[model samples]
Target: MTFSPTTLGTGIAGYNFLLRTRATQQAALANSPQVARDTEHFREKLKDIQTSDQLMEDRAMLRVALGAFGLEDDLDNKAFIKKILDSDLADSKSLANRLADKRYLAFAKAFNFAGESGPQLPDGKSAEDVTRDLAAIRTADDLLGNTSLLRATLKTFDLEGDIGNTFFLKKVLESDPTDPASFARRLADPRYAELAEAFDLSDKVKDRNTVYGFASVFADAAATLETPEDLLEDETLLTEALRVFGLENDVYRPDFLDSVLRSNLNDSTSFANQLEDKRYAALAGVFDFHEMAQAALAEEPFTSTLQSFVTTLNARSEPVTTSNDFFSDIKLMLETYKFFGLPSRSNQAGYVNRILNSDRSDPAAMIHGVTDGRYLALADAFRIEEPNTDRIYPPEFADQVVTNYLDRQFEISIGESDESMRVALSMERDLGKVIGNAKGNDSRWYGVMASNLLREVFETVFQLPDSFGTLDVDRQLKELKHRSESYFGTSALEDFTDPDRMEDLRRRYLMQSNLQSSATSSSASIVLSLLSRG
Candidate 1:
């Protein structure tokens, strides 16, 4: 059932055929014994490995591991790979940072044997799923065994980097938050106390939510401040606390306010007590550096809350899926939109209807045609035309790594057979992602130049010299910009968002590649003939 690339021949026609049927071909490959056995072996063995040495010890997993990041060539270079994996990422002179190809750095980050980013939830796990898992943790062993829950809790407190440091985590969770001299309190970072506050080690578990509401979340943050200066540094906490005490106008007068906050309210002559308005004393009382006053956090961040609401709107979004519930929901949605700063079509039901109905992924789709990046981000977030499953967690992170490995394996396989088709596949896969970023074209262009597969295709299609790659970064950017304008009449990556433009790019590369191959062949023949005559 294997569809060999040899049958497809070479150049533009073959490229077109392959592009049209790539999904099916990859599906077939995924099921084949060679691919299936290797992937299954890697999956089964991956969990046992927590270090680069362990990974390098297993050749089968190592193959898939390296293949995932297009680093398959380094299969024999385990020492070098291990060096990069263990290098101090903070040092610019480290082996990983010194390399021109960033794939090595990416490869190290993906494995994260050195705990570069700490722990995150495994990929594809929903928020609801995490909440359930966290609720189930009633003991120290339960907390340790469910690393996902542990990591999610840490992440909520912005302490995800300590994910691998399980021993330290156990000590923090087991400590009493009420005791200021305890392990959690002893840490200079107030986030640790916040962590200690959220978890009760005596089998009393609480729901951990990273989201903020002005009342309880701010109140919880207020209790954690050890100094008046600590209170001033956080704008969100400082502003909200000021508003609570009717001193919102004094936000700009930091030094004056800082002095006032430091004043002992216990003394009648204190700055806060002397103020005519009683609100100043109240502000000083709550923020006094003496004892901590804590509150619980409200569930859901603003974006997460907004996304959750949009999740409910997808089914009733399109015009054709009408129901009586839709009218009432639409009314609620308008207010929700206004609250979240989303652009809502208040009176324009027709426009809203089309946008809701349209496929955000399609260039011809109504939402995709919107000029505003905000609308695009909103539309993309909603996924109205398809499933909108949550992509968060300690749960999602593991699956994300696995998916990356397999997809990279697929890319590398195609590359081994035909490099042209490999580059074409990368463009088809990554073009939209690069263009969809809110960054300007120069940043996006660097994304192309950074990738060996992508840069080769663009250089070939635009007929840039091989020496163009040798130019300074700025000079190279200028060349890409100049060539892009000469060919496409625009230097913007956003202009290439359409699938048709990508295909056009593919066709150009294929045609030019074939021409180059033919000319090289002709020159080689002349040289051979001269050698024979001589």
Candidate 2:
């Protein structure tokens, strides 16, 4: 059978013995085969976890993690746990912060997984990595097969937020980028043109020769035209020439286009000049059959001016050398540095550089010689000189969690015999954390009201009626403050951090809880007579 932790007795004398022998009993419980197995299982399973979501997925890891905070019963409330873990505690409206219970807030902060983990360029695929092999995307059909690339293209042009219009994207890809009136050119955002150039979707500017060929062919076709109607007989020449003037769609209306082509450009009343779009006029001007040579030269069919602009974007990778660079990767954060009792010196590159690069394997390393322990912590977390450490949380976090899980489990086991003893023990364990985390008295007061164990103990010690909980939050806060000042000589919860005050509070809780238990037995007409302090 698992070793059940023993409580001495219910009175002040019993409670003191429980306190005095706690260390020894704790050692015995920790060494018990069952407790050791539970702790070992937790330690073994928690090694791979770095995120809160990852922890939730594992029953083993979640058991210990939830148990560490006395929340093991919530193991099945996965969705609620997820919401709490995902919340931004800094935002007052976040689920964790909005809840009256601050236990969820502490749970969320323990495995802080929401938001960016650190300052480094991501170790995995990053937002900038959403690219496709533009070389492989030969046809519009090829682009359709690659949805990731489609999203990447959409993201690059700052259009990923909206549902992409596949038809419009295809048209942009198939339009002649060299022609300013093409689909991409018609769009207000000029980045579309850049996308077209990158994909060369129209295939018009495949090489310098392709551009020259189309321009030469149009010039040749225009010179041989006896009438504009004669040019329509040659579909190839007509389409190429129409695209240059951004009138490729008009190729189907050959007869009308021919008539417009034949119209005199200088006449405002001409069919071509009378249209809303001047593209028809430009088309007629270019194929005027008289100024064909000068028109072809003047239009300069895509002079390759934007060629350099179409060049591939190079992704830059700079080596991490400075402390600024070190902090960019927050996973390497030395948590121990916060306890250094000094101002944040992450900006002190000279001191940090020596710390990061110092050889720690050697007994006489520069890091070990430093009087400030923060430098040693920095070197240990980064191990920059060693270089291949892959730990997610710092090494110490695992041990801290293991000890917390073990201690909480032992404290809970004490409650099996005497439920009141559990609340007393949990108060000693939980009160410091509750007060320490809160910014003010109001916050600390709410913290106590939020926790079940603390609330039960306070409710008994202050002799508050069960209906006291139904009062307005402000009223409850006022009453709690008054009760605290009368009981502990200070409304401030900080005073209870002293060992004397905590011990006194523990004694009051036990005595009050014992009186309540006896009164309940005395009042019951059919008392079971089974009320032993056990």
Candidate 2 residue-wise lDDT, 417-531, digit = tens: 8888777767876888788778898888888988778888888889999999999989999999999899988898888889999988888889999998888878773454445
Q: Which candidate is the best by TM-score?
A: 2
- Candidate 2 structure lDDT: 0.64
Question: In model 1, where do residues sit more than 4 Å from their true spots?
Answer: 1-7, 88-98, 116-413, 428-447, 470-473, 494-498, 521-534
TM-score of 2: 0.48
> Residue 229 lDDT in model 2?
64
Candidate 1, 425-480: lDDT as tens digits = 67765666555533888888887787677788889988888888888999989888
State TM-scores per candidate.
0.46, 0.48
Best candidate, lDDT: 2
TM-score of 1: 0.46
Please report how far candidate 2 places residue 500 from its true position, in Å: 1.8
Q: Which runs of model 2 end up more than 4 angstroms from their true locations?
A: 32-34, 89-92, 115-391, 525-534
Per-candidate Cα lDDT values, in order, are 0.62, 0.64
